[model samples]
Target: MASELHEAIFMAKQERHKNLFLNYRNLNNFPVELLKDEGMQFLERLFMKRNSLTTLPENLAQKIPNLIELYLHSNNIAIIPQAIGELVKLQSLDLSDNALQIICPEIGQLRSLRHLRLANNQLKFLPQELGDLRELETLDVSMNLLRTLPERLHQCVSLQCLTADRNLLHCLPRQLCLLPDLNELSMAANCLTSLPLDLGRSMELQFVFVDNNAHLKGLPSYLYNKVIGCSGCGLALQISDMKQLCLTLGDVTVPLPSEVKAIGSESERVLPLEELACRVLHAAYDWTCKDVKLRTPFLMPKSLLDVVQWPLGHCHRCSQPMFTIIYPKLFPLRETALAGVHRSTVSFVAYCCSSRCMSTFDLQA
Candidate 1:
């Protein structure tokens, strides 16, 4: 009876049953022994989804050398071994709904990989080498806590769909729109108030879901007239002349009130002008004036100050402040603010609550 059953399964494979669905049956380990004994050589697709799998078997890549599509999703797997990269012919991989925290950097070796899904995982960030997946066209990395993207992400010239919605992305990687073939981008629930000036560089873009961004106010001139619908289908857009649409953020300079002083270990020190500009623009710190002199009625620009009161308390316009008791540093949203700045960074005057007051006292003017 056992020999007859094995022969029947092998016969099914010989009849071109390449797609196998062995999911939801509490499959612990892959049926490697059964498959090897049956001599099933035409296997190309395997589905091990919805299992109680804690980890993959040690020799999975060796057993499924010809497998083009593998689905290990909705499992308890935590780690994807680097050996998985040996499957050079693999085109699609689904590891979503797992306990994976770190994406193996060796995944870039899958030269034929086109669809990679790591959604619904605990990944904090991706490997910088992920840009090496030159053939990747669809990548789903949503529902994670990724703060920033790797700078080399622009190398994936073939990427068509990138879904990174519902993450902690403060700013979209400017290089994202540089992909000439990219079509869809979903960045709904993030802190992005604006997109890259060169965002219109992509010629194939069609749909963009940028709702739910509380801080976002407007789009570039080229994208202004592109807002289409705003209902169940979401506000879609069909843009033209991408080269004329995207524009970089304008260079705007404002003044601060109080004299900038570098807080030191023992004593206060004056910072250099060049270094001060870098820090003030990029690394503005939150400070409370313990003894401030109201020079001329404390009138500040609304663009500079988030809040201002009688007893001047200034929370510098910066990214989220990582405040510590001994030392603290504020990171800004724009990296260009630090452009052409010096090292051993000095303290520059950030938005002063009394900017208008200070302007009235301008010596040259």
Candidate 2:
């Protein structure tokens, strides 16, 4: 007696189906049964989400060479098969909530791909070849371990929306601003210190979310015309810029950056940080300050103060604790108050825990 899968396969062959839906199936392994027949030759879309798939079937390209959209969300997929590159016609691919560690460079072969989602994965670095996906428009790499993006990404001229929130990136690629079609960028909860100078040149850009980056004092001069989300941050932007901000809190009370010692030592070589216990704390600690006029900010977790051996306070402008509780640091955000005369300010505030991002004193409390 043929099983349900066999029946489905028979139906697909008989009807010459183009779309296949097999979601919510307690599938432990790829259903090789579906590929044994020639009927799948016409298959273009495949939905197999909510399954227990640990890995993709070998030779998936051989079975569904004509595939366009593939949905494999909520699976235990640790690695995408190299054969994935074979599906040249693939456009939309969803591999969210998987255990993937890295994206295969072969993905660059998908010239027709438009949308790609890799959120909620363990990816440490992306393959530079991904820039070859010229047709890609929307990309979500949020909640990953990415420290930097490939500069080659500038080649993806069609990108419209990019979301890279909750990553360890300390800076962004300037090439990102070269794209003329990009419209929206969500980079909240990152360690970015500054923005690309050409950010204002993108005619299509309309929305940006860069809040929660403690060291980011304000947008580049060019972005002053656009209103973006900027709460829980200190800025030197004019009051007009603050007023234009998107905030859930009543009014935007933007404050100046913390005090800065000098720009010389600030330009020192970069240092690697141990995996941060919390990126939120790291960014916040860098911007919290007792005096709103200061150039450096200090927002630290109380629990971490002792572990890092940071003193209560010292080098007030540098936010550097008296002791040797050091971590990776970035150049301070230089704010010019004249720019934000008409800005809106918010009252949302938090005190620093130790000096610098590890402030010892509470600025707000």
Candidate 3:
């Protein structure tokens, strides 16, 4: 095996091959022969999958400086040297199925990187500098020990697909909803109790998976049409748990109600002062419209402006802008038409601006 491996590398060097495949080589370390004598400068791609290699040489970039793709999947690699940042032209990197506990922040220097796979690792957290990869399109950090994702990841403007399934995430960064090009999101098997309200609001986002979240009883209405996997949710609901999921609008913080406040029509009820003010301000500011050509300079405080900018969410029934409060209506998945399709036990929560919409809103409709 050793002779065969050496022969392959020798042949590649003699021919100045642009691609090198050394998979299943039973190698325990990066072959020193490849890094000798100026290295294979012409090598553009390297495959070293399913190896016993534990670490990459610090001078790897100096030797194979032109590498565009590096595949080191299913290895025992525990650490990535900072020298990896020197691979400015690298476009794809796969460090999946490894023993990595931390990623060097210098990884941000890979300005040309488009895809990064770090699944099946022992990572506890990722660096904030990962957001610097403006060209990043796909990021997979599944099957790890991550408790939270970096909020700065929203800067990956070109990102389209993000997968963090089977992690310890409790909540996602709300800024992630601002990704303009993001289309698919998967967070199945996490400790998430609630999702960002703005999730799936983007037209580009078409698929969302949150299956097996036993504590999550409700999903934002925006994800109603896009949610593809949601089985094994709504198994438990506690009033104490709901209290922790409060929605803060401007200076007012409202706890998510565990049950419907009332069961009357709109005319039979008088709107709360806070709710009424929110509705009036929303209309005055034309908050529902995508474009606002204000005729005068708006002088509202930043706190109030934030409320108008980000409402609780649009009413699921009337599509009216909801702020300050929400009349939540829950529906069992088995009773709804989606039950047969998704096979989920999770109950869906529909948000309404008033009791009227809440009474009339139909999950089937």
Candidate with top TM-score is: 3
Which residues of candidate 1, in runs, are more than 4 Å off?
1-16, 32-41, 225-365
Candidate 3: where is the Cα deviation over 4 Å?
232-365
The TM-score of candidate 1 is 0.58
**TM-score for all predictions?**
0.58, 0.64, 0.66
**Candidate 2 per-residue lDDT over residues 235-259, each given as its tens digit:** 1233332223221222323332222
lDDT of 1 by residue, 1-365 (tens): 33654554566566856776667757565555434653444668888799867776556667667779989889888888888888888999999888888888888889899999988888889998889989999999888778777777789888888888777887878888678787777776766666775664455765556555545544433332232111111101332322331212233333321224223423432323332333333322234544334322233453233221211111222222211000011122123333223111112222211211101011111
Between 1 and 2, whose TM-score is larger? 2
Ranking by lDDT: 3, 2, 1
Those runs of model 2 whose alpha carbons end farther than 4 Å from true positions after fitting are 232-365
Clash number for every model? 1, 38, 0
Worst 10 residues of 2 by lDDT: 341-350
Give the alpha carbon lDDT tens digit for every residue of 217-292 in model 3: 5567676555355431111233343334355555545443322232254433343345545555555564555544
